[model samples]
Target chain A: MRPAAPMSIKPQADAVQLVLAALIAFALALPFATLKPNRIVPGQPLFLLDGPPFWARALVILALIALATVTWLGCRPSLRIVVTATALMAVILALGSTAGHLPPSNAYARLSPAAGFWLLTGALGLGIADGFARLKPSPLAGLMAVLAAVLILAGLFSSGWLSGISILREYQGRSDVFWREAVQHVWLAIGSLAAAIIIGIPFGLLCHRRPRLKAVALNGLNIVQTIPSIALFGILIGPMAWIGSHVPGASALGIAGIGAAPAFVALLLYSLLPMVANTLSGLAAVPRDLIEAARGMGMTDRQRLWKVEVPLALPVLLAAVRIVLVQNIGLATVAALIGGGGFGVFVFQGLGQNAADLILLGALPTVGLAFVAAVIMDALIAWSAPRKGRGSIA
Target chain B: MTFASRAIPRLIGLCLLLGLFLQPQLFEPVFRPLANTSAPSIYAQAELWSLALSHVVLALGATLGALILAVSAAVVVTRSWGASFLPLSRSIANIGQTFPPVAVLALAVPALGFGDRPTFVALLIYGLLPIFETTLTGLTTLPAPVMEAARGSGMTEWQCLRTVELPLALPLIVAGFRLSLVIGLSTAAIGSTVAARTLGEVIIAGLQSNNLAFIVQGGLAVAGLAVLAHDALTALEIWARRRTRLAV
Candidate 1:
């Protein structure tokens, strides 16, 4: 079998990957210009023959074509296309607006060079970083990244049918609304996640030390998790009100079940299981002999925990945190249902109003928040890991 | 014989006691409206059974589908140069896990309409990653020497995988399924909002009406179902582990 020829396929893979990158660039830029001002009037689309003023539309279409071409042709550094597409769209919009032919309604209709661009860029960067993770550029890694990107795009396309397209167009003018809501939504997600991590980590370590306390703590979390979040909020409402009524100090806390407080509490409860369970698991994974060795070295329990156990356990603990963060990023939107206020308001509102653009506006940020957090967490874990030649003590 | 075993029963007894003791007070508000003492309980309706049955059917179907796809992907990626797909698989799986099942529902509702189909599709996507990740992890963790020994015994790749890798990986795979099933149980509640008539509907209804008893009833029903499903899966795990050892 000739020793399998040492498996050299990186160059071939990289070349193909470059083409795919170019194509993706082209794809993003395509709709911006070519999408012509298609206004549907319930039954038929009111197609303006003038159509977004030829020059403006031309610039948009040209940028889109460039993006699609880049996406089609790009290779290993596929995220390059996303950046290229965003830059192209921005330039096109800027240049078109200055020419005085930019349609008033479509002028604010910026080709969202934000969500899709950032997501694709992050994916490409992470995939490449991880590709070299095994100390060699693994072709298998590149392929997987490409396949995932394709799948996400496929899901987007499949979700975007004919009516879906028209619905999205309706919110072209509501860009301001979408942008404001998206920003606040992202902030809420980050704030809640930070609170969960800060509180959960210490709680996890406390439960881990006692051993006897582990079951009760873990089961309590499981029960908390099992309680439908909405019910938990409802359960809290009566007590929050009761306290607000009688307690002078509590009234000042602005303890309302319909806003940020209830949502924050519900999200924190959701964060417990993964955080606590993984913390315990990580602690358990520390080699027993290492603990003995640390003790032999005359290190205190706290010293051993901080210097030895935690460093080793960091990766697993981070994984748990990542799971919780991603989950909360998505679930927090449901908090909008109780008038707690977040991006979910747009999503549920869009649903009620039968407006696809509003739903996309809400959901896009959620996906964006989850994506950004997952990537950052992953990068942090990779960076903190012990380097080569470090003592394994395995 | 051990305190662990004894503790288990105590835990169960405590939960039961809490439920029973709280039931009267909890039911007071719900029953107060039907004070005539003539109305039948809502739990007795045929609708409740249908909802429960539909939920079970969806869960079982999604679970089975996930198992097939995840295991196959795991086996291929773990055993060969097909590992090129690993990053993609991992990322896609993560997306499935992270992609709000609610978002999936909202997006899906437009295409599939208000029903069980969209719910099942969303659940299936959400279900695959944990199982796939665990399967791959377990297979990679298998002792290399054992695999080599099996290969040296003139076994084909397929037979070696079948008789060795899979058996060794069973425990971890079971652990993965446990996680997936629990997540599915919670998420399955969202199906009710989209018109599937699941236990979530009861809970949401109770919430809308501000009825504590209904909330408790809905909450308890879903929680009970989750615990029961988890325990059943645990039993299956035990049985599978025994069977594998028996084969060895």
Candidate 2:
């Protein structure tokens, strides 16, 4: 990490420059926001200069110029990062303030961040992630920073600073059902993951114990995994409905054709492959001599497995848990397509109505949840790893 | 062994192609009994064959697109002169992989309006990482002695790379392509939600109308494509390994 000598600073064009250039170009050429007369109607694109308040407009122009200058100069990496982050924050604050002050011509008139804003955020997000990786090199610190930022954003919005943004308005409109849907999404994702672990571990163990069964089981699971989530959920409904209507105690057990049951079942089936495959690999990864040592200590096969094998294979198993959790969180969103209530309810609703903000409402939390799940599981997987050079599929 | 290797995929591919094209007619009778509503048993808004074709196009087109982008990027990054780009390229690929495919697909709607175009964009993004990562591994892990001999024979860097590294990496690259293609196929069904004319349309239509027959037909056809694609590529993988002189 030597500081570049001014004379020796060969053009080290980094992602920061690429990102800032993209942001500046987008701000100049594209619309920063859209003003819709109604939620479902296609909105008029509002360019960077079109947002209200001359002072805010001037401030945004200054920020863009500053970003372009830094990018052109190929300055210090840390300074570039600082400027890039500041630019995003300032633009956001400006956007919020502009939206808040807009005098609506109609009751349903709304302003939402458009493609230009997305590009600005996206490019800067990438730049920040890359810059931090090179500059700080502590993923844990980065993760904590992400949490604090999300909390601050939540606080800001709750204080109604950005309530004028259409997406936030959509959230406010459905704030009651929003929590319910969020709960359903989390329940389906985690519940399915828990079921997979409970059922898959023993199944994986059986496959590990016997080669013939392993081939058949793994192949079947592979086939199952290949089915699209919606199709799988669709296919489950008929048989499940039959069971619910005809079989004793099925209704009592909450088995239904098109509700959370089918979605949960499909998610569990989808989860089994990674769970089983990882378990097989993890069990195989355990040292043979250690198991023998346990046997020599007069341990039964069960005792040896419990005392020796599982602990050694734990990290790779946790890797499986991580994969399943992240995957289930995503697939559960599609569950709403099948009458299984989740955030996907908003996504499909948005699509059906052609309401862009509603789609964002559904999509944002799903990605965020999957992201947080991956981060937490990664931390857990790292913690569970033995102090050896063992590799797990994180 | 060779006969079976060729025949297995050919058989599955043949059956799947037929099933994919003729799914509506094939399922009409079964669905007539299954679909209790007064609505038509078969999906007829658009021909099932055309829907299936668009489905295949979305997935395969993306896979091929990802292949070209990732393979070239990986090749460049693995070159001695291009080594400095490896870490950055890997980070880019990693970021693509962390975003779930569905989210990627959804996000595309905001930037690019819905249709096959957005789905294609999402699929291309989703499929890049596996091929890039695998290609990186394949090129970087070339046997040193083989590279040495190629160099000693007075081959130019370009000539040696053309003849040696890529051929050696083909099997791994094919394996990566297989993974990417399988994922794309499975995911293509969801594209119908975005007006992409995929088989997912049948499932969606059925769900809306409360028709079970349409769902089964669509689900079975989509699943059939997945299995056939996997087997076909596995067959290709076997041939690649054999040609590359790896034990198959």
Q: What DockQ does every candidate get?
A: 0.31, 0.58
Model 2 lDDT, residue A358, Cα: 90
Accuracy of chain B in candidate 2 (TM-score) = 0.91
lDDT per residue (tens digit) for residues A1-394 in model 1: 5555544432334432443455445444432222323321122111112323565446655654554454444333445435443443343333323323324566323222222333344444443443334234233444454456556544543443221232244444565776666665665666766787788778878987787788888878876776655456545555555667787876678666455666767787788788888888988888998899999999998899899998998988888878887877788777776556667887777766654556676776677677766766766666566667785544
| lDDT tens readout by residue for model 1, B1-248 | 49588458646845653453334344455545522245332433335556666766776677778778888889887766667666556656655666776776666654465667777777777678889988988888777778788989999988988889898889778877877776677667767666665767766665566554455555566666666666667767888878866765
For model 1, the stretches where C-alpha displacement exceeds 4 angstroms are A1-195, A227-247, A285-313, A388-394, B1-46, B76-83, B242-248
Instruction: Give per-residue lDDT, candidate 1, residue B11.
Output: 67
- Maximum-TM-score candidate: 2
